[model samples]
Target: MNLSLEITGLTKSYADSGFMLDNVSLAIPSGTIMGFVGENGAGKTTTIKSILNTVQIDSGTIRLLGKEMTDRDTALREDIGVVLDSANFSAILTPGKLAKVMRGIYRQWDQELYVRLTDKFALPMNRKIKEFSRGMTMKLAIAAAMSHHPKLLILDEATSGLDPITREEILEVFLEFVEDEHHAILMSSHITSDLEKIADYITFIHQGKIILTAMKDELIYDYGVARCTSDQFRRIAEGDRLAYRVKEHQTDVLVKDRRGFGQQYSGIMVDQVSIDEILLLLVKGEN
Candidate 1:
């Protein structure tokens, strides 16, 4: 199927409050970059953890590179590179020593790529990890993840604190990684601007549920931000495809079926929405 990852009927929860994820399903095709978009506490990280088997699932199935995923026997994981917010390196070790430790852990680790990336990022090899700044630490994590040459890369907020130049450099690396037509990525981040530049698909989650998911191009082309007075909003929003809505003296609406909405609401102004605008309207709305 050329699909790199799949999740079906995935469910997870805390003790008594509510489900962190509920019957969620996701699929990422090989060579595609899928952006996992959500606000804080929106279950994006939980879903990623479930797929990686770091957390147990209540009832569901996960397949990575066409193999069923389980908590034990992480052989499939060896083919995947993961970067979280923190590097997970020993604070006392130097970058060179950390490289050796990771090489021992992954059977397919590429030492040449590791060395090249270290040089490319211009990381100081002898400095302790604890001494590195936040941006430098993020670069180190990227270097480690790319060193393994994995088929799939899963990142959770990997670019939260980097400067513009560093973020652009990382984006270039991601672009180069997908050039092979066999690699894929699932990146979770609140920084919508970064995702807009590189992601091919977008998924939005709010309040522990998936609000929308689709190709990035289609989202930009088809969905729209509609602003109107309160009376105009009421008259225009009474449709099946009104994906979501927010109300003030003026209102913003997200319509997935843009053609249908356009036909129905000829009086309202509908403009193309960016990833950030879509996220803002969805997360900030009153349900």
Candidate 2:
């Protein structure tokens, strides 16, 4: 399989805050979306900054487009479109002027595509970016990112505040972009429901460390939460449970297989787990 982005032992730290990206690593394969899951301070943005080489790293390797990535590799960046939590475009430039600037920067910039995207998103061509609402700014940013037809997209909180209809429209564009086997995406989002819709893989990060990485279907379909009394919990094998939390009268355990656990422990109730439940279990529960 062709990998669009690959990281190995990627580590970084800040002196004053003492937050470190400890041994961070993951891979994004071509034609697939990797949903980066984490809490606000779980090193999601830090990891992304490291990938962009905007922050200096203490250790590890990062490869983009099958080649080693460095801050100096300006050429490689043209192939990757990024939308951070907020739009970073100039305040004074209108979408029309911004398109002109983009035309100067990207050798392969498509004017027709830019116009189409802008029109589709209902962005005003003459309106200054500073005058736009948060959602409008976000839509303009995304439109700009895709105008040049980048092969990889790195979006952090890209879909956060958009309305359902707009989000659904943008999501369709994303799905269409990856129809070619050479495209891929690494989207960092708090919206698990959005990830559930489009992401092929899910990587969970907590406190600067990667805790879990699995196929979306496996995490959703195969994994489960086993709820039982403390007495029954003792009967569960050590290997059977991934993590567990104790409630007042019962214990909730995270098990890898819903059907298998139900069959093994006949009376214990094993229910299907969602991404949010999985995050709660892995972060709050203990083995």
lDDT of each: 0.85, 0.91
Tell me each candidate's RMSD, in Å, in order: 1.9, 1.1
Clashing pairs in model 2? none
Clashes of 2: 0
lDDT at 53, model 1 = 87
**lDDT by residue for model 2 (12-57), tens:** 9999999999999899999999999998899999999888888889
Show where candidate 2 strays beyond 4 Å: none
| Number of the top-ranking candidate, with lDDT as the measure | 2
Candidate 1 Cα deviation (angstroms), residue 19: 4.5
TM accuracy, model 2 = 0.97
Error of 2 at 76 (Å): 1.1
